[model samples]
Target: MTGLRYVYAVCRPFDAPLQAQLTGVADDPPRLLPHGDLVAVVSHVPEADFSEEALRAHLENLDWLTATARAHQQVVDALTVVTTPLPLRLATVFRDDSGVRQMLEEREAAFRRTLDRLNGRVEWGVKVFVETERTEQAGSEPAQPAPKPASGRDYLRQRRRQSRTNEDLWSRAEEFASGLHTALAGRADDARLHAPQNPRLSGAAGRNVLNAAYLVSRDTSEEFVEMVDRTKDDAPGIRVELTGPWAAYSFAGDETGRGEADEERHGESGGESGEEKTGEES
Candidate 1:
């Protein structure tokens, strides 16, 4: 394959071979480029599409970005199964083999440090959605119409009551999320709380109150999963989600000099944000 080189991840050498038909971005099969003790996982892509000027235009298109991120993620996922991988930002491209080697050389120390920290660990994503009152009331009961407000004063009073109720629900949700994060953090080696996810992007119902990633050792992952399960039903109107055993993307740190647009790839699920498929898929 000939063109610009798209680098997917950096990791230590491993004996395990990638899946025979595993294809990366631009439909090119990935190859390992070893630099010192670190290996850069790279594949070729058309310069017309991957070059700096071309990428700036393509990234504006969501369809193109999503496809690229998914393909990039597939390579990272494969690496994760065999060994811990330090995932680079989406759309990381280089001019050629020498450029790729220079990157590995430049970032060697940082890569080794992050890889060592994430060696046997994986990332687990936890999200909590609070059910809205309208959602809860669906198909339950039809309430009698309230008498028309006697005056503007009464109308204002009614509005205040509704506002307070909404505030109370949100407060409760925040409190629950705080407690849950505390409990989960107790079990995880490290934890990060990202901004609440947008419902439009997540496609999950209700209000997203918690978007967090926890780093846990492989041996205790099962116990960590159970810990999340036990809290799923703890709050009446709160919903909990768990995704992972994925490569520690959230904990990998930004050694790649990733742009702001690239950072958007990690919305709620660390690396798989804005994706519809479950973590187990691909």
Candidate 2:
């Protein structure tokens, strides 16, 4: 029989029991696959139901995905409460237990190192959205401009002017992002700048200038949040949003063995580029 695959996470040995209590759908038990000191929280899926079309359907439905993800996260958080756990990428899967075992064997050292670095720490996300500048309305009567420039030189000058304006805006935004990152870095175990996303969807009244996540020790979570709050209060024209005290989802690299190398890589370079929420889609 072809068994279904479910990818969960790798955590310390002591975390397994608490994770089991909070995991899976309804009363269904989560499969705790252990390897040495590391444990993978998984569950069996039906092969026929996990085909390409089915997988696509599953991913496309936000409600289903969100519920499943929340359930999965509950377990990861439970584990985190007891021990440091590395969260795998969303939707990581394997054909069976053997596949998971092989992956653990292949990347054993890297996983160990990642765990070592992340031990006793958790991840938090903070996003800053810059309010869009309100455009000034021209007076009621259409303002007549000077005679149209007949020379190409004038047109080139106008183009250059616009280009400079665009460059200036981006430069200022980058500067702001950098400063915010620096401010928070002092209070965090690690800080990463994430790529910005669309303003409309990210619940921002204006443009999103900074999207970032920080990994901080559990004991320091409150202090880190306070620092972020202070930065938001001090900065004008920007609104910051914070989520997490969550499992180190953003910091968790590729614990799954399905060649998710690029997608699951973490640390300073692995986060979202801007307004995009890392690991939100999958």
Candidate 3:
């Protein structure tokens, strides 16, 4: 038999049935690749050849990645909706069922403990974007004739002024984001700051000020959304986009051999929420 690759996550057994009902990456039936008390949730990769080039190609295509991720997320969310699921990172793969079982056996205790901590909770993603303040006044500004530069000193002064303006804008943006983070922290179980989005892709003159994620209990989702909505209203200059109730993707770090150790030490903090906000680079 040709072996298939799989992605493993530590979740409650009750979630398996719900996860099966949800759609997954491929049309192939999803299965619970189980080992003892732990289960390795899996979907088969039907590709005949699992070469490095094939993996690279799949990873490079954003569309493929997003679709697969969304599909995988659907299944994961179904599980998370019922259980505290520790989501695996995108493109995590195992050579076969045996590999998954061996991993589960090796890290069984850690996985169980992680699941215990995450039970009855879900992840939420939030992003803040600041639209550039219009420097030019609207409807009244008239075009002025360019003034002739008398000396190189004048040109240098112009460059310096522009640079200073840019720096100040960025500094203000950071301060605003920091305040937002501080405010949201009170309402979240854990929080994380992600790198800001690029201005070009964000299409906002100001900047992508904040990228963040929060983990909250299922019962607290409403309160969390309310907090984010309030933050948006308070900060008119910045637009906040929220997404998810997704699996804890950003929180799940490298899970190779150290899977057990990692989970045991996986201290929860503020993490970037799983919001699918698009920027220059994902």
Q: Pick the candidate with the highest TM-score.
A: 1
> Model 3: what TM-score?
0.70
| lDDT comparison, 1 vs 3, better candidate | 1
Candidate 1: C-alpha lDDT = 0.78
Candidate 3: global Cα-lDDT?
0.59
Compose the digit string of candidate 1's lDDT tens values, residues 1-282: 678888888999999999889999999999999988999999988988876667767766767877887788888889988888888877777878898898888878888889999988988888888787542343447545556899999999988876876677778888999999999999999998887887666567889888898999999999999999998877766788898777777788885323233334335423333332111100
* Candidate 3 lDDT tens digits, 47-142: 542234455565555566556656665666666666666766544556677767776788788887777766666667777665545322223565
| Candidates, ranked, TM-score | 1, 3, 2
RMSD per model, one decimal: 6.0, 7.9, 8.2
The candidate, 1 or 3, that scores higher on TM-score is 1
Provide the TM-score for each candidate, comma-separated. Answer: 0.84, 0.68, 0.70
In model 2, which runs have C-alpha deviations exceeding 4 angstroms?
1-3, 19-21, 25-27, 60-64, 133-176, 256-282
- lDDT for position 268 in model 1: 41
In model 2, which range of ten residues has the least summed lDDT?
A: 273-282
Full-model lDDT for every candidate: 0.78, 0.62, 0.59
Error of 3 at 272 (Å): 18
